[model samples]
Target: MKQVIIIGAGPAGLTAAHELLSRAKDMFAVTILEESAEIGGISRTVRWHGNRMDIGGHRFFSKEDRVNRWWAQRMPPQGAPAYDDKALGRECSLTAGGPDPEKEDRVMLTRRRVSRIYYNRRFFDYPITMKPQTFRNLGLAATAKAGCSYLASCAHKLPETNLENFYINRFGRTLYGMFFEGYTEKLWGRHPRDISADWGSQRVKGLSVSAVLKDMLKKAAGKKQEADETSLIEQFQYPKFGPGQLWEEAAKEIENMGGVIRKNCSVKKVHTEQGRVTSVTVQTESGTEELRGDYFLSSMPLKDLVCGMNDVPSSVAEIAAGLPYRDFVTVGLLVKKLNLKNETKIRTLSGLVPDCWIYIQDTGVRLGRLQIFNNWSPYMVAKPADTVWIGLEYFCTEGDSFWNMTDRQCTDFATQELLRMGILTSASDVLDTHRERVKKAYPAYFDTYAQIDQLTAYLDQFENLFCIGRNGQHRYNNMDHSMMTAFLAADNLLAGKNDKAAIWNVNTEKTYQEEKNESGEGGAI
Candidate 1:
């Protein structure tokens, strides 16, 4: 049997390990080396005083039926116990005969997709829906100006070279300034004009004013909605605890199938012989060890992966070294209540705004987004009925001032921002707080990103090396997108196919991960 070594136990790495074992266990023996002691990389669930925090919110909504089936196989969906959501008017999907969430611990629950943009002290529908309240929120004069700007943009288009032009072309300069400009700056720590348009195209390719209009007309005409548009997804499946639950379960299944997972192991060097990867040197709690493998699947940061290699072309190495990444920090806070009221008819355990997450478009603070853990899954919180569990996400560079701050300092700063925004009535409302920082959370699309194709071509020369996941490909991929990359990679290795085009092309199309082979396997050929 050929030994396979996979780096980083994130979605991509875990999925690749699981796929190889489940597909051809006798042909491949897998060993996963993770740098951290957690199962799911950024998708991990951080528990403090009983409440759990999903580092970055993951909504299990995919257009691929195979991916949905994979998730359902792991955590079967069931009917809601006490959260009678239909009273709120939002439609949801709940299946029966899976597992009763009230009695069973490992079950999936359907959650409503309620997200709003908090700007100017008023909540606007995310993606700027064309509704009376939206127009009223923006005064008549501003609304008219926005309409005129959109018309002018449609009449004359600018070359989409940078992210600024991409947003303006799709959303008009008026809406881009009010919505996209500041948030983009806050997210990447750079002006939108300085970033590449590739990020915008992949992220919001299907979202536009015309698209929103089409959705509104379809809804008004009582037509079926398409599943490809993720922004319009009304409901999604979530594990009982958090996203980490699914990954942990996958890891267990892998072990049960004779796969090995080693935590607290860091890959320090990628040993290459001629044009192929032969082994990897890792640093562990015990000591250093060299792991020789027939195949290597890496989900680590591409910059670090390339840097750790022995021999690489100067231009390729230079581009890899200059790759930029944005770090993330989530401050979990358990509070008594929020100052915002339940303006919608949605009934909650307490009178709270029914938002799984809120985008901080005000840009007056460093806060990037707010996540209500209770809204994601009631099981995420220790007391979903009495207390509110929230997460404040901030984007920054590693070792920066904000990232360098102590946990106490960071929590204090985050609490002050909530108080400044009037989300908290007093400091006494905060019951507890915890902070977690993640490095290389988001692969940026600037700096030497333009020459990434050359870097990938050089790396592709290694016949035994396969790159997967967001950090591996240096792309902004969602959870399902990362998993699909591994699926394609596993399919290639098992079928003795050496070309990586299908794996790399997983999310290039408008509809991500929808194309499947004739065999109904989730891959693009």
Candidate 2:
């Protein structure tokens, strides 16, 4: 049997293990080495006192049927039960209260996406809809200025070089300055002009000022678009407890399928002979051990992977070290439901704007975004009726002051910022607080990002080594996109061929065609 070594048990690594073990159990010996004790990397949910918090919100929706089917096989939808829960000593009931007690293990909840931009102490539709309330809030003067700038942008037609130009080309200067400037700067710690246009293209590719206006016009006329745009998807599925449940179940299935998984095993070095990887050295509680493998897959950060190599080239090492990342902090504040209702002047706790999250576009505070965990799912909070949990996200560099702040200081700062933004009336409203800091949360796309192409090309020379996933590829891919890359890599391994080009071609838009070979294995085209 051919031995396979997988690094990092995130969505990509787990997906690769599942695919390989399911397809060729007798032919391949799969072993997964995960550095962290948990299954999910950034996608894992943190549980505290019967409350679950998604580090960042993960919406399970993908145009790829394969990805959807993979998730469905593990966590089925509510109505269509995948297994007989009664066999597991619980009844399955499809009711308004939620799935039956037994079905809770595999059931997924469908939630409508509701996000708004909180700017200038007012909430506006996230897609920038042309509504009376939006116009009234902006006032005539600012509205006219935005309109004139948009018209001038159309007339001048500036070339889109950087993020600033990309937004101006689409939404014009006035709107970009008001909506995109501060938020982008705060998120990346750089001016929009200094950031690469690739970030804008990957993030806000479909939506534009004209598109929103046209959609609003079509809505008024009671018309619908023929194509289903993924960007404008209104609803998505999520696990009952949190996204971590999906991967945890997947890890169990892999182990049951005769695949070995070693948690808390940190990879120290990847030993390569000539142009192919031969084995990997990992540090565990018992000390270091070397595992030999015919094929190796890495989902660790590209920089670390390059530096961890036995004898990497100086040029490659320099380029890898130059790649930057943006760190993140989420300060979860548990507040009294009654206090929040009174401050917002809403009739009931449920009356508060049903937004899963809100973008903090206001320049008064350092907060980049706010997530309403209760709105995400009632199960996210311990007591739905008595309390609400809000996540205040702040983006900063690893050693920056914001990231260096102690947990108490971060909680205190977030609480003060919430009051300043009028989310709460007083400090006494806070019941409890939890802070989570994530390093290298986002792969930075700056002017120096062009060096990535050289680095990728150099790394591709290794025949048996595959680098796939967000941080592995040094690309800011969403969860599904990362899975797609892994899927392609697994297909290559099963087919006994290397298809690095096709694996790298999986773009941010998730628009890649697949074809089956003579052996009936899926391969990306």
Candidate 3:
């Protein structure tokens, strides 16, 4: 039997294990080692006051249909409450009502709806919509200034180099400063001009400032573009219980296929010999133990993974350890009452939350993104009138002052900020709050990141050892993109004749391709 040891039981690791087991049923022995006591990595959903909530926000908006098909095969049956819309895309009927009596263990559902981004201390249509909100904020003067500056900058020329220049080229310096720069700086903890433009170009490439402006103009003039049924924003699918349900289901399936998942077991050292991974030394509840493997897949932070390797040159290890990460502090608040007056479902409420996730550009406010959980799923709360769950995501790094604060202190700080913004009136209105701190949540790309080429070069030494996922590849990946990377990695490994380096570059062409499909704009209801 061919044995494979997969490290980190995240979507990537779990998917790889599943594919391997299903393809070579009787010939593979798979073991997934997860450091946390749970199966899902960052996508894990937690419960407070008998309701499920995501640490941050997790949505199902992949452009790939195969990924959708893979999920559909594992999801619960029709009566299980799935949300599918022709206009919006995909939906799951997971509710707070309770689990399915037949497949209670396999299925978890929630009725929470989704919310949009909040900006400038006011609500605007996210994805940059044309509405009363935009006009009110920009006014005639600022709007004119923005238009003139944008055209002038476009005429002047951009170097095609850094993020600041990229945004200035597209949206102009004035709008970039007001809307884009500060929020991005806060998330990455660096000045926008210093960060490479590739980050924004890759993530926000499909979105053009010209498109937004044109769409706004058309809508303002009482005109609408021909609708394309196949845009990402038109609709999306989500797990009923939260995004974590998908992974938990995958974990159960992996175990059922004679695979073992060892949770709460942290790998202390990855032992390698003769330029190959030999065994891993893990610390469990009892003590440390060594396990051997034929092939290894890691989804942990690349820096951390390289550091954990037992036999690496000190210079190489130092270079790996030097890579930085941006951490996150999520404060989940249980509100005593349903706050929104519209009461419309969250999917249609994209601009409803004012912004799906508010960007705390004003440093005076400590919260980076304020996400309304109930909007994502009504089932996030056990009782509709009982309490509503809201997540305030604060971006910080490990050992930072905010990170060092206790959960209670962090919650207090979040609540205080809400009060300061006049969003929350009294502590009494907040029934309870919980804080979750994720270390090395996102990899930071510095101006001098190219200097750390040694780490990638060292990782390249192992042919069978694949590093993937968001943290795995140190790239900003959406759920679908992350899953795609994992899928591509497995496809390459299973084929036994492909280059892993090339597989990491999957979505580069995704931008232009998507633009061709979505050419027009739509009017608001």
Candidate 4:
């Protein structure tokens, strides 16, 4: 009998398998079942036209130094062969008197353009960068109106209980409307007030009005740019290929340690008896195989996990069904030619938009965030001038047009939007287009998220069954956080500890003190 049965091939599952076997040194058997054909879950990168493009935009920023070093050590013994850092030149060219035009294009395919918030038929500088730019966008008359609104917002700036109140307290009505309202509303398919404020608090921290004003003042003078320098807080790490490469490599490591990763093997049913997991029936190419295991670690979606369980109480099943998720559809377009503009050289578009991911605040535009894959890694796509992949991320419900649209329809829509926005000249520039619809990609944090406590209580009845991962725990965690949860779970199992709820709550702190020491440099890699 396999010692452990891991129910997903994502980073969390792979990490769990690795840590389990590595710590024990072949003390137990482990197996992973993945519904998809490949590893990495949403982090998986698909090969399109000989180029690798991610499911969406994935950045490698992490607060943990060990996570950073783990990646550095795992990547191919040698880093990607040195390309002449031409993209770096283009990034520098974004500033005045930076790189020469000929040298910049020789290094990069395109230059990064300024990203603005489009709202109420006007574009505004996001993060409220410069007072002059903000005033220009809002106009003198509107600025006065915003000032009056800001005072009213200040009077009501109590501790926020919901997402809407949080934003209203932080940025006031006008700024929040122009910058956050539409895109956020579209992302969750719910009002900002209906969603919990915890999501907002965690995602955006340390950026206050005073901080932005200070950064803008610093930029206006000849002083060093605080925006670029302090934005990331510290360094980040990425795989040579793309974000998916990390999971693929981790999968290889797990297999190397004698653990089996069964791809395209879907879990049909999870049989339980007396609140303990009994056996898991998987559907492979052959047929259904009931694999009995002493322990089960499921990284699959929480709703699907509960649905797959046999003979569960109907009330518990209904509660699991009540947990909602927001889906995402990404349209990846490969464009021909690199330099669409003459002046600036675009390397990566991290802050080009609102966040690293641009928010489409305009109601008229169908796309949400636009991620330039070439910015993450030039090697992400096949060739430079000939083919460059741009990811148009649109969030929607399962029934939304973006989700229900045919692949061809999405690709056409993306192409048309690129032309409409003047990002591309015509359809002739588009070499190839692809669209991927991800169902239940994000756990929607509604006002009723507290109801998850009831669902978690039901799962707690199971002695040997554990659910760990982003969707597994129904927590919006990043890659390292998810992997760390799995690692902690395996440790608990090995230690014969039953407290698993604590594992789900990892990465809860903002500006974690444990991740770094008093000295600003990394603690340990």
Candidate 4 lDDT over 412-452, as tens digits, reads 98888767766677799888888877777787677346577
For each candidate, the alpha-carbon lDDT, in order, equals 0.84, 0.77, 0.67, 0.67
Kindly give the number of clashing pairs for every candidate.
0, 0, 35, 4
- Kindly list the per-residue Cα lDDT of model 1 for residues 1-525, writing each as its tens digit: 999999999999999999999999999999999999998898777888878998878887787677788888898886553456552222111121232333467778778888788888888887679999899999999999999999988999999999999889988999999988998899889999999988877777767788889989999999987767676766778888898999999999999999999999999999999888999999999999999999999999999999999978788889999999999989999999999978776776567798988888878999988989888876777767678999998999999999999999999999999999999989999999999999988888899999999998988899989999889999888888889999988998898877888778877896532111111111000
lDDT of 4: 0.67
- The sequence of per-residue lDDT tens digits that candidate 2 reaches over residues 1-525 is 999999989889999999999999999999999997888888888887667888777777766688889989999876533223342122112212443455466668776666678898787777777888889889999999999999888889777788889889888899999988988888888898988887777666656788787767777898874233555555667787878888889989999999999999999998888899998999998999999999999999998898889788898888898888888888888887522332232222345566777788977789988878876666676766567788888888888898898999999999999888788888998989899888787887884477888888888889888988888898777788789889999999988887599888776442221110100101000
lDDT of 1 at 245: 93
Q: How far is candidate 4 from the true structure (C-alpha RMSD, Å)?
A: 7.0
Query: In candidate 1, which residue pairs get closer than 3 Å at backbone N, Cα or C atoms, i.e. clash?
Result: none
Question: What is the Å distance of residue 106 in model 2 from its true position?
Answer: 1.7
Q: How do the candidates rank by TM-score, highest first? A: 1, 2, 3, 4
Worst 10 residues of 4 by lDDT: 516-525
Error of 1 at 265 (Å): 0.5
Candidate 4 stretches with Cα past 4 Å from truth are 76-128, 131-138, 142-148, 205-207, 210-235, 337-357, 510-525
Considering every candidate listed, which one attains the maximal lDDT? 1
Candidate 2's TM-score reads 0.90
